[model samples]
Target: MTDSSAAPLRGGAVGIVTATLAVAAHGMAGGGWADGSALALLIVVSIGIGAMTALPERSTVLLLPALMAGQLLAHIALSLGAAEMHNHSLLPSTAMIAFHAAASVIAGLMIAAAERLYGPITSIVRAVLALLTPLPDGSAVGRVSMSVAVPSVDGTALDWVISRRGPPVSVY
Candidate 1:
């Protein structure tokens, strides 16, 4: 894909991943889910975070901060945005904050590494596939074709095989 298309794709990927991880981490750490208006607001916040970090170049410096900020904002949004059923407190405990921080760092590192290596890895895979793919004409490069001497024209399967030499020969 072109660089222009790639920018939006990468941005969307980062945004979606950040939002998913934040929400998952919040729930996994025993933080109650905030539905209704809170959920809507969190989506907006995540999109904003993604837009802010949407650069064509791979940058851990930018992505890490964006991810960290997204996580923090998500936490606050969920904590304070819950309805009566959730009843979550606005202030999080030390452990909860620590969990979010740790998750943010680990996830950020992984995402950054993947983004940094994506281009090179994709090129390598494409090169390998190209090398392994067969030619359109079904002929091998630098191969010499040999003529076979037929004593007689016999209507047999062997005659079919003998007509075409090398890899393209078929007995069917």
Candidate 2:
């Protein structure tokens, strides 16, 4: 059977793809090579973030900084391009970059949280099923132990669901 642990990684991948495509579409309508190229680079950085989060074991502490760095790099590229073309001022560029960075970081965190939460939520559901229905041994109907481990802000909690039959079926 496929391991359930990979679901979060898959979700992160989907988030990255969505972010990249959104930026690509924006770049396409941006009406200049500089803007388009800058957005393209941002997409590359988003891919990196996706890759980092795609690992089976990822450190949540590093997520913020990684995302910030990616945003800063993309912003710098865009700012420089705009300056060379004289299409935008440094002040406005900086403001826009900050806004975009904040938005991106917030979106990334939300995506991560959703992905992380999926396991426990689904496990809780399954545990409920186990409790409500009889198993082959008829032991799970009334003797089920259901627990949901919610993650903390830093992602330093054991997020799992445990349903006991003859043995424990834990999804973490």
Candidate 3:
């Protein structure tokens, strides 16, 4: 992806993660879920994502949920704006709040699940390869293949095995 795209993409990731933390924390504070349970689930989901990201080439799996959730947010913003202008009703806005939150969390968990469903490492490799589209006489996909390459070595290998895939990756 272009730098412009990558930058926003990274931001989307950070936003989702931070958003997840905030909501989970809010849920905990609200006493909606057991103090530890909500946090625990969040941690597990985070760890699951990270673990799945680590597999040799499954890093792309990590982006799936982020992208999905990001798109959801973008769409929500657009529709919310229209709704706010037209209906003057808080319904869509309120639904966006609830649905967006749930969707993001679900997206995160689904990303983790995708990693598990398909070996992270292996899936990542496939994702990368998918970017290297072979030349054709002329085609859109062939014209734009830009998947980031997955590397063999990643930070603190063993810790990564157990660590949650959050930002600020440890340098090893």
Candidate 4:
């Protein structure tokens, strides 16, 4: 079994939190706090996914694809509805649905582009490392140098993205 002791939950937790914040911010843009409630479930699922990866028997190799797929669908949905969103609007329901459909396609493509740019190798490595490291709690240097991302990590850390495996057991 991999060293479960070393697989801290903070990184995945942070990812969930940040993702939730972003989602909430998007929802709040539409003038509602109700969407943020979904974030609690997101945090739980994120941590559970990470912890499952760290377990002794099963590997989390399969988890990433499903997680990625679900998130892709969600963001696609968000981007779709958000495109047609306005603080105040009285457009016809048909127009709104049509707009949302177009937007969903675009957002889905955006996620697809992100997946292609990052590639499976990069994505899997990051997922594994996120499961095994103090991802959310780190020094500035560590944050800048030793992190993972898809499209980006922090807003400014895009160029510093990682594309390698997790740290060796001895390094931990």
Give Cα-based local distance difference scores for all models.
0.72, 0.56, 0.45, 0.43
Tens digit of per-residue lDDT, candidate 3, span 20-118: 643443333331322334344444444444343344433444465643444343433333434323333322344444655666566666544533444
- Superposed on all Cα atoms, model 3 deviates from the true structure by an RMSD in Å of 22.2
Clashing residue pairs found in predicted model 4: none
On residues 1-172, what C-alpha lDDT tens digit does candidate 4 reach at each position?
2233323432243234334543544344452332443445444554554454434443333334434433433344445344444354333234333433444344434433443344465669988988888456444553444665456445465544655577668844
- Residue pairs with colliding backbones in model 3 are 50-165, 55-121, 56-121, 57-121, 57-124, 57-125, 58-120, 58-124
Off by over 4 Å in 1: 1-10, 86-88, 132-172
Worst 10 residues of 3 by lDDT: 1-10
What's each prediction's clash count?
A: 0, 0, 8, 0
lDDT of 4 at 101: 43
TM-score of each: 0.64, 0.46, 0.26, 0.27
Tens digits of per-residue lDDT, candidate 1, 54-171, equal 7666455666777888888877777666656454576667767777788778877776666666777788998999999945775658878899776555657466555554576677
Q: What is the C-alpha RMSD of each candidate to the true structure, in Å?
A: 13.1, 20.3, 22.2, 23.7
Q: How many pairs of residues collide in model 4?
A: 0
Candidate 2: the clashing residue pairs are: none
Clashing pairs in 1: none
